[model samples]
Target: MCDSVAIIGAGNIGRAIAEGLVAAGSYAPAEVHVTRRRVDRLADLAERGFRVSADNPGVVAACDTVLVAVQPQALDAVLTGIAPRVEAGRHLLVSVVSGASIAAIRRHVGPDVPIVRAMPNTAVALRESMTCLAAEAAHAGALDRVAELFRAVGATLVIDEEHMVPATALCACGVAFFPRAVRAACQGGIEIGFHPEEALRMAAQTALGAAALVRDRGRHPEREIDSVTTPRGCTIAGLNEMEHRGLFLRFHQGDHDLRREGGVAVRR
Candidate 1:
């Protein structure tokens, strides 16, 4: 969708995005530019056919799309640095920094510039991330185009800006949440007398297969659960124990709060 994109920070998330863009062939190698205050971090992108520099204004002025990938705390300084060079209708600024709301960014850049607020997690590197987007004063085409850019990496959802914060906590933060559950599953492996590595492989594969079941069959999750839980089988016994411990309710409750804390710039 974009011939070139300028990334403000070449850090982990920013690098993932650049790599995603290149891998998906949406942006050519020379057309993608990445800028960072630290020169060393820019080398990786430089090697990948991307334009690299420490000059924010230059990159912002040169690219078709400007992606603000700075840390939450650094947003003010970063945005302030390039605000002078940004001319209305000249740049499309997309903020992938979490916890920062569009209203906040609008206040910094004014209302004329098209600002897009996004919540994309680390899983983007694998092209398996779930991303949510919200725009301030833009049309359906703008959102869809942004969605297409994000879809180059993984799945993208256009959601109300109000839900962006919780989406950050649940989906973005939730990417890290899955690992803890897998770790607990590994502990279960040890108790069953299997080597940690062996048990981890089995447990993780089972979970992977379950995910495939959801995507391939589009079966209601309950239907799959019923198929797995035999009459008083081990799966049911384990599930009953998890339910007793408040684990089931806990996950849902987390989702509720994640969605509810939508507007605050918690990333700050």
Candidate 2:
């Protein structure tokens, strides 16, 4: 278990991590401290027995593991606030702020502090996130610990820091992308005479099943597609129509655009 955890900027993503940790039995509510600019914003967490405060430095001083989940634009101020209180070799800093590099964070917090970057989608609320992590060679142990913590929430991958941005585009932004596809499918269902709620449920469950087939069976998605698309079938007709309309191409282009935009794909 974590000795103690502090989540700076107890916004949406930060709240998700905290809730997941507690729900997964990885940590007790009292063992986590969450800070927000306005302590009133953290009332729900406080009611759940988590320590809630507006003082970032105080929270950092009390915890061994700190998750920096602030907005990228607010990171500098947060780092500066907690820098003096951060004890080198004692505090493990993990940042989930997109577009902020380790080098920039180190410059603010000091070079001796171990830093890891993690990118997790909003799915973290359900403990079903796909989180990608990266850290410097010197911080490998810290990286592993960070990975272990996130694994309680969902799948985690350790990759080169250079790939962190791309991972953000693929996993973080891809969360929104996948749901949009589900919505489109729901719309199509509605057009075919299903009620909106029924269509949504059917589309969501189908998407879930498709994902589980690839995840659990470890087969290529094409294999599953092949199984469904028999000769001259309606499935193939729809698939061909979508392909011809460039549906998959649009997703690829969106990923490219996200990367080009420096992985600031979705606002926290």
Candidate 3:
């Protein structure tokens, strides 16, 4: 178990990770330290018993594990600030900052520190994120430890660093994509006369059930569709309509576009 953790730049992703750790009972709130430029924004975390401050280097010096969740643009400054304080062989650095390569981080922190890149969605708040991890061969042990920590909150996969960008588009960005589909379903339900609240609940639950079928049963989506679709059935008709409307094509296009743009597709 990780004895202590410090989340640098405790913004949305940072806060979500901290919440996931505490919610999973992986770490007590007091064992986690959260830092941001504005300490006032972290008052709630302090109230929850987490150590909160604006002193990044101080927190880095105190924690065993450090999660760097700052914006890509802010990464260099944060890394530079904390680099001197990071003790070799003592701190495990897990970065969630998008677009920053492991080599770039190493350049800032030096060669001896173990660095792992993690891509986890906001679903982490619900302990249901699909997190992807990547690290160099030299840091394999640190990667395993970080993977275990993330597994407390959700499923995890280890992949080549070269594939991390694509994984970000598919898993992290896919979080937003799936929710938008659910919202579209809710809209369709509203048009069919269901109350908005009821429609949203039903649509969300149905989506969950569909996903669970694929995950729990290990069935291909098309195979599951075949079981529910029948000749002259409404299911088949709706499926055809969605296909005709380019729903799947749009999703594929979005993935391609994200990849082409270097995986910086989502602003927030």
- lDDT against the true structure, per candidate, is 0.82, 0.91, 0.93
Number of the top TM-score candidate:
3
Tens digits of per-residue lDDT for model 3, 38-85:
999999999999999999999998898999999999999999999999
Ranking the candidates on lDDT from highest down gives 3, 2, 1
lDDT of 1 by residue, 68-176 (tens): 9998889999989888877777777899987788878877778788888878887787787789999855555567778888998888988998777778877788776
Q: How accurate is candidate 1 locally (lDDT)?
A: 0.82
* lDDT score for residue 227 of model 2: 91
| 156: Cα error in model 3, Å | 0.2
How does candidate 3 fare on TM-score?
0.98
Model 2 spans > 4 angstroms off: 266-268
lDDT (Cα, 0-100) at 212 in candidate 1: 81
Candidate number achieving the greatest lDDT relative to the actual structure: 3
Question: What total of clashing residue pairs does each candidate reach?
Answer: 2, 0, 0
Candidate 1 TM-score versus the reference: 0.88
TM-score of 2: 0.96
| lDDT at 29, model 3 | 97
Candidate 2 scores a C-alpha RMSD against the true structure in Å of 1.7
Per-candidate TM-scores read: 0.88, 0.96, 0.98
lDDT string, candidate 2, 203-241, tens digits: 999999999999999999999999998898999999999
